[model samples]
Target: MTENATGGEVTFADMRLRPELLDVLSALGYEEPTPIQKEAIPPLTEGRDLLGQAATGTGKTAAFALPVLERLTPQGDGAGPVALVLVPTRELAIQVSEAFHRYGRILGARVLPMYGGAPFGRQLQAIKRGVDVVVATPGRALDHIGRGTLDLEGLRTVVLDEADEMLDMGFADDIEAILAATPATRQTVLFSATLPPRIDGIARRHLSDPVRIEMGHTAGEGRETTPLVEQSAYLVARAHKPAALGRLLDIEAPTAAIIFCRTRDEVDQLTETMNGRGHRAEALHGGMEQEQRDRVMSRLRAGTADLLIATDVAARGLDIEQLTHVVNYNVPSAPESYVHRIGRVGRAGREGVALTLVEPREHRMLKAIERVTRQRIPVERLPTVADLQARRMELTRAALEECLLQDDLESFHAVVESLTDEFDLMEVALAAVKLAHESSGATPDEEEIPEVAPRAVDKRRGPRESAHDGERYQRGPGGGMTRLFFSVGRSAGIRPQDLVGAIAGESSLSGRDIGAIEIADRFSLVEVPQAAADEVIAALRQATIKGRRPTVRRERDTRGRRPR
Candidate 1:
């Protein structure tokens, strides 16, 4: 590790990182460490307790996971977990566990994920058999401890991930109990987005002479002070949002952009809508299988999918260097979330753009975001049909200019000369230009997209809050049936089969318990027996359907009737 002139730490290439882990990072195109990683990794590898203050998507997981892998003992048959990671949500648990698995694969590390709605018996068996690392949610881990199914005697490191979110969710007691159960001498690492009083208290009580690392954005001389993201918004009527978004895409023509929706059904619907508009769009949510999610990401990285419609949770730790834009299909509810969403772009000093589609009512939230970032987000008018045509024509002209400059036109010159005898030279040139424009689909027509009234902002709705809420599902009169609503639909590249398969496989529920599924443009509604609603929701909560998380809740009927 090297210290910079500004007293900030830097990770040098010569610093030790496991060869296998480095190989994986190289394969993933991660060359340098993030600021947090540079400061946190050295101390963590030295077995010192660490309290890190950094927000999500800062590459903190790797900062800790690398140390954990470096310090853990080799696996033996049924040797019990050596490193334990506690997270707030099951999705996070799975994500952390996968990270450990990916980094430790060459070391033959056995990583197991234990969370609610998963088979407790299977998890218990895995614990009994032994694992190098255990990633679990606090509630479920505590349950395992109480049942004497998990052993922490051999633990070498304990990581409290997203500590602030856990505290916010009222898991302080559970966390304390789990910490007390672990060995007193074990190294403890706590990572939180904010160092609130509660987190400070935990650090004082749990960590011994720990190193504190904080990272902040700094303005440098001759270096750009602005964030890499060129932030902007488009004002449009609620009903014309889809059209507006499509038109904007047509104009900007980003190589790749992630369109963020608040709910899984919204991701699905938006993906479908974009696809219908002749864009190669894909949807990613939590309700999908790990394998399917991998495929979607593969396609995105391979440039097969230009637009990815996703939810915040489902897109965590997603690093796409080719990404040139981020579209907030809905304004984020919180400033922190907005920061994370836009942070995906504007990385490594690359120029990027963040485009938010703000409805009339969301203007206030947009203002709040600007205030928090201390940056002015320029508001722009929605793209008009004429504007789109102009942009497309410009693109067509640019492509033709490039062809004329670089292409070997000798072969085409003979063909052009033959046609010149019968056709006027200007006429032939116009015809060629017209053919090029048409082939590129750069010609725009004047068909207006149908508008839908903007629905009232659902105060109770959001990806994180609704993740664990039980009220999103409704039970039938007989108490035997339940229906859940997803904010994703056909437009988000979601199918009924994707929802059914995800719930049935990831949860303790069966296919017979799942009933009808209705997919729309911005959302989808699925019915399951009331007996299995909770289990299905918990199961799908962590699962990624269509490479995003299905904001699963009890469905409210068209008449506004909710299941009992």
Candidate 2:
């Protein structure tokens, strides 16, 4: 169903939202409703069951969330959980819960997120106090139900988000059980990227005659061409990829992009490597907590993060309008996955670019992708010094053009006038332009990004230790000193680099500030500058490394003997 034109003005004013919510959104600068929100909000507000098919990053969360907020009653005397949202992953559960909290804060609406990995006592406590909304993953929600800690008897609305992913992850039975427990008369909404048969069965079984809204496709038209996507690929040795990718990014300089990798470990390593090369990069994978993922996405959306290295599963359903590029760090196993990866860009009639880094052996897979998509992905060569220079010049010219278009140049005229009197007008103009361009790294003669060996195929925890050896070494604490720990020597998977990275990324401490890290299976010790110990512990408390929270704190002395 299309959005009714009548509600346009009201729909646009998320500011008219409850005062607290308006403050949050306004502070966050969310000024407009995405297309999904425009179409889904009205019907949902009317209490109609809905089946919405939309891509990731289309603001689907706000689409369903706004209506949920509008319909929810305050928690003052409710026995509920008035609204229940079931997501596939713990990360999504937290994200949706946070959204509900943000939107309903002014209304005094209470929302709780329940998921695995977190201690159950916190969830139980929150439930006992009463919640207007519960955002949960299927497995943990079902656990709560079986334990009698969660009651859905008062639930008014039930939402199944990313239903297909849940099904894919083997949670279909759990989903069915959860839906069965909810009241039969409740308003049911299911949102998925695709309507596979499994999803169709779920809809038929649960939803009363629903209004279906499928965005991105016209009634009679065939699949629309991704005219905005400028598809290209490069052949490089596996060892040369990092350097090649860095160079490509340097030349293209996408406003935002997600570099898709095959594994979580790869995501972390690539993110660190990219950051070292001076790109504002972040990593997203299942290994991170919901809060961390949210922060990473926030950074990406806010332009604080220019490159996001992530696994496909972690990046699923991510829609970032500012994303102008999609890079395949490794060839995807299937062509459909490739399509989904690149589709993240070239959306909503905006131009986008997709680049795939293909190893020699993956040429056949590339050909297979071409066969399935019915489009030829042109092979491109690595950028040479000349090409890099030309690209920088183009960027400089673009910046100058933009500056000329703006109205804030009156104060700068004096500087230009004084310089013009002292030198030839053309030379002065060029010099001033050169200074501005150089400040932005738009200099044609800027040093080339170093060519590291292509990333080696190692099953180890870090990059290759030697220039020629494929054996990767974990990153050590940067400073010569090491922090002593009392907890290590037994159970934790704590490693030297793990301690260093966790401290450096999560805390205010720089890589140079961290000294040395020593890890044992049960407990581990790290070395950081004494001055930054408190900050390091505080940061570690919030960081999730290797799927578990690090118990980082100052080491208490057990014996009189201390190592010098």
What are the TM-scores, per candidate, against the unseen true structure?
0.53, 0.47
Worst 10 residues of 2 by lDDT: 451-460
Model 2, 112-228: lDDT tens digits are 987655667998999988888899877667778977999899888999997765654446666788888999889999998668788899989899889898754433221343867
Backbone-clash count (model 2): 17
Model 2 TM-score, 2 decimals: 0.47
Give the runs in model 1 whose Cα sits over 4 Å from its true position.
1-12, 76-78, 217-223, 226-230, 233-249, 253-373, 376-438, 442-563
TM-score of 1: 0.53
10 residues in a row with least lDDT, candidate 1: 453-462
- In candidate 2, stretches whose alpha carbon ends up further than 4 angstroms from where it belongs are 1-10, 14-24, 219-249, 253-564
The numbered model that scores best in lDDT is 1
Candidate 1, residue 403: lDDT: 93
Residue 209 C-alpha lDDT in model 1: 96
